[model samples]
Target: MTEAAFSIADIPIYGRILLAPMDGISDAPFRCITRRLGSAYTVSEFINTHDFSKLRHYQIARLAFQETERPFGFQLLDNDAGRMAEVGARLYELFKPDFFDINMGCCAPRVTSRGAGACMMRNLDLIRDSFRRLGQAVPVPLTGKMRLGWDETDLNYRAVAEAVVAEGARLVALHGRTNKMKYGGKARWEPIRELKQALPVPVIGNGDVNNLADARRLFEETGCDGIMIGRAAMANPWIFAGLDRDEVPIAEVFALARYQVRAMHAFYPGEKGLVAFRKFIKAYLAPCGLPYEKIVQLMKVTELEGLLEMLADIEAELGGQGQSRFGWEGLANPFEKEQKA
Candidate 1:
C-alpha cells in the first residue's frame, strides 16, 4: 500500500480517492466492493436521525459494516442539534465507527425542506452548536460534508466550515455547488481552492469529478488533500482502481458484477436483494451496448440464481473472456482531451 494521503483526526486515510457517502447507494455491499478496489475508506449512507429516533429498521441497518472497512464513518443528517449529538453518541456506542460525519450537503427537498441538509447552512449558530454538542457527545472525531451554501447570494461555506472546525470537525468535504444549483450547472472548483487555503483540517474536494482524469484535475487545481467521487462511481466502480470504464476488460466487469450481486443477495437476502440489484444493472451493462430489450429482460428477473445465470449468458453473448463486442465510441470518456494540431 502507498503512504497515507492524509489523516482525519488521528486516523490515516491510505488513499486520496474516496467513495462519497451517497444515500441509498453507498451501502455496505457497495462500500466493500469499492474499498477492495482501492477506495481509501467507507462512509455509510445518510442515517436520518428523524427516522432513527423512531427505530426505523432501514436506518439502523444502514450502519452495518465489516471490519475491513476501517476508518469508517456514519453520516448523520438532521436539523436538531441535540438529536444529532444524542444519536451520534448512541451510534458510537453501538457501531463504534472511526468517525461521525454531519450531513450539510444534501439538497433533496425532503431533506432541506425540514431545514436539515443544505438548509442547515443558513444558520451558522446551528452549525456551531451542532458541532460543539457532537464534539462533546461522541468520543470519535467529528467531520462534515457541506455545499457552498444555500445559494449564490448565501455562499457562506467558509463561515460554516470555520464554525464546525472551531467546535471540533477534523475534516471538511466541500461539494463546490450550492443548494440552489442542486446538481445543475458546473461545480465551482474555485471555492474548493479557497477552502483548502482557509481551513485547518484536510479538505476533500467533491463535485464534477467523474473519472480518474477529473480526479487528477481536482487535486491539481485545488491542491486539496483528497477527492470524493459520487454519481460517476455508480457506473464505473473501477474508477476507484484508477481504470476508466472503457479501459476495463469485459471479463473483469462480469466477474465484479457477479460478485456484487451475490454480496448484495447475502446482505439484503431473497428477492429484496435481487430488487436492489436492478438499480445497478443498467450502469454495469452500459458499455456493452446490450439492447434495451435484453437489459430489461435481465432486470425483470425475480430470483438471484436466475439473475446470475442471465448475467453469465449475456457476458458470453457479448464476447466471453478475451474479446469485447461493444463499441468504444459509445462509452463517454471525459478525460479524452481535444488535441491541437
Candidate 2:
C-alpha cells in the first residue's frame, strides 16, 4: 500500500489531493470519479442539519456513497450545537462515515444569513460548544473547514481554531480568505502557515490552488498536511491525478466525460440525470475550442442519447479516437504508480 500522507483520526488518507465538498458539483458520481482518479478521500456536499433532521430526501441522497469511497465524510452546516450533534449521531447510525466535518467556511448568503457557515467564526464560544457536543455525540473524530474569519476587521481564526481543537476537532481545513472576501481576491497563505504552526493536528490548506505546481507551492509555503481542490476540480478532475487540463490527451478527456455522464445518469433518476449533467458538459468542453453555436447546441440537448450523439460527433471532430498520435492507451491509476514508487 502507498504510505498515507495523513490521517483523519485513525482512518488513513493515502493522497494529499482531496476533492472539496462542493454543493451540486461534488455529487456521488463526481466524487467517485475523482476518487478513482486519485483524490485522497471524499466529502459529501453540505448537509444542512435542519433539512437532514427533518428526513428530507435531497439531503438524505447527498449522504449516499459507494463502499469504495471509504474514508468519506459528511459535512454538516448549522448554527445549533444540539441539532448538529443529534443529526451527527443519526447519520453515523445510518451511513457510518469515516468522520464528520463541520462546515464553518461557506460564505453563501443563504448559509451565512442563518448565522451558520463563516458566521460561526464570529463566536468562539459557539465553536467550542459545537465541537464539545459533536465529540460527545459521535464515536468518530470530528473535523472543521473554515475561512480566516467573518471579515478583515475580525480575523479571529486563531481563537476559533484553538477553541475547536480544545473541544475535540482532530483536523482543520483552512480556506485562506475572510468570509467577506467571498472569493473576491487572492487567498492569503500567511494565515495557513500560522495555523500549521499553531495547530497540533493536521492542517489542510485550501483556496487559489489551481494546478499541481500551485499545489506544490501551497505545501512549500504552508507546510500543510493536505491540499483541497474546489472550483479547479470542476474543470480538471485530472488535477487529483497530478495532470493538468492541457496535459490530458483528447481521447482520455472524452472517455472521462462520457464516463461521468453515464455515472450521473445511473445515480440520478430519469431526465433529472441529464438535466443535472448539463452543468458539467460546458466544463468538459471548454478546452475543445468548439464554436459558440455548436457549444449551445450541445448544451441544449436534453435526451441522454441525443447528448451522447452530440458528444460523439464532437469527439470525432476533435480527433479523440486517434489516440495513437498522443501515444495514450487509457487512464492509468496514478495511485498505483505512487504505490510502486
Least accurate 10 contiguous residues by lDDT in model 1: 332-341
RMSD of each: 8.4, 5.3
Please, what are the lDDT tens digits per residue for candidate 1 over residues 1-341? Answer: 67788999899998999899988788887888788788998888998988788764543347788787888999999999999988888889988999999999989999899999899999888888889898899888989999999999999999998888888899999999999999999999998999999998999999989888899999999999999999999988889988999898887787777777776776764476678878887887887888899988987999878988998898888876853223222333211231211
Q: What is the lDDT of every predicted structure here?
A: 0.85, 0.84
Clash pairs for candidate 1: none
Q: In candidate 2, which residue ranges exceed 4 Å CA deviation?
A: 55-58, 322-341
So what's the TM-score on candidate 1? 0.92
Candidate 1: C-alpha lDDT: 0.85
Q: Give candidate 1 misplaced runs (Cα > 4 Å).
A: 56-58, 322-341
